[model samples]
Target chain A: MPVYNARIIVTLRSSILDPEGTAIEHALHELTYTSCTNVRVGKYITMNVEAESEENAREILDQACRKLLANQVMEDYSYTLEETEREPA
Target chain B: MPVYNARIIVTLRSSILDPEGTAIEHALHELTYTSCTNVRVGKYITMNVEAESEENAREILDQACRKLLANQVMEDYSYTLEETEREPA
Candidate 1:
């Protein structure tokens, strides 16, 4: 079985108000950190899973996102999966 | 000035309801991804900053978390900073 690494990102829909992001930006200005901008709040989920193939992993991950991971009405999600690194002998 | 990389994680305070995480868990079960459990939703923010010292970076990050990045009533946050990686010749 091949081990797959997945990075899942979930963010509030554009229509939603992200008080968290807004607050962080304000604090940055107060600290004299002017270079930071466009702060957004979202989830970054890293998962390692065993799967027979990439297609199978994608199928399973999609199901997870739609059913358990993201809310259709208020949140949007995207994910990327890569094969696990192998150690050199 | 040294460049610092910060990873900010924001989670819903225990008292808050996380429908988003709940939904993701439910979806995972349906997709036959049984190994995953205790799924939670949070933000992972990556920032590259130029700071004179670690203390200064911490102060700014803290201010950002309080004023803009997190909701005190419902959210909590933690951050870690490491010096940026240098390119190898």
Candidate 2:
């Protein structure tokens, strides 16, 4: 079986207000990082999967992202998948 | 002034337990993505910074990550910075 590593980024839709983001922006200003703006926060997920092929890996990850990793209603997600060698025990 | 965009990824240290990650992994299994394992979740932050130079931009972002974006004791963070064209009005 081929092992694949997938990195997924899930972010809120632009129209939705992000309270966490707002709080971080305020904290940054208080810390004198005034040059920073439009700060948005999201989720980063890294997972490893054992699959038969690259396409199979992608399909599995896409399904995972849609079904569990992200909320499709208010969040958007993108991911990158790459093959990796299995780790030695 | 130059403007730079930074993407920051902050992940919990391996020594720390990630309940979110465990929950996600269980969800995937229930959803039949049984091959997927070692799922970890973290934070993804995007911000724009206006600065005098590339180094200045990096310094500001580094400070932002340290002071606001991540908890240094339990999380580790890394970022990439790129120059982006200003958004049109």
Candidate 3:
């Protein structure tokens, strides 16, 4: 079986108010980074999926994101997949 | 002035414990996603950085990551930078 590394990001909808991000943005401004704006924060998740092929790996991860990692009503998710050599048993 | 979209990911160092990730991994197993392993979670941050050039944008974001976005002792951070057209005033 080939093992794929999946990196997933779950972000809030643009219209959502992200207090965490807003606080960070304010902190940055206080730190003299006044030009930075519109800060938003999300989740970054990574895991290994062992499957027969790349497509299978993606399917499994997509399911994970849709079913568990993200909330459909308020959040969106995206993932990047890369194949890695299977670890020795 | 050029505007850049910065996407930053801050992850815990490998040796650090990630309870949030562990709980999710267990939930995945219960959901029958047994092939998923070594799940780790981090923060994804997006912001608009208005700077003179790509180099300046990278520098500013790097500083932000170091100063506040990541805890140096337990976390590691990386970012991708893309230039975007300045929004019309």
Q: What TM-score does model 1 achieve against the real structure?
A: 0.56
Which residue pairs show backbone clashes in model 2? none
Model 2: C-alpha RMSD to truth? 1.4
By lDDT rank, best first, the candidates go 3, 2, 1
Per-residue alpha-carbon lDDT of candidate 3 for residues A1-89, written as tens digits (9 for 90 to 100): 99999999999999888999999999999999998999999999999999999999988988999899999799999999999988999
Which parts of model 2 are misplaced by more than 4 Å? B87-89
Sort order, TM-score high to low: 3, 2, 1
Report how closely model 3 matches the true complex, as a DockQ value: 0.93
| Local lDDT at B79 for model 3 | 92
**Model 3: share of real contacts kept:** 0.96
RMSD of 1: 8.0
lDDT, candidate 1, equals: 0.73
Q: Candidate 2, A57: how far from true, in Å?
A: 0.7
lDDT of 1 by residue, A1-89 (tens): 67677778878887888787677667777777775554557786656656788888788778777776677788888888898863354
Q: Using DockQ as the measure, name the better of candidate 1 and candidate 2.
A: 2
Q: TM-score of A-chain in each prediction? A: 0.84, 0.94, 0.95
lDDT by residue (B1-89, candidate 2, tens digit) is 77898899999999999999999999889888899999899999998899998999988877777877789999999999899897775
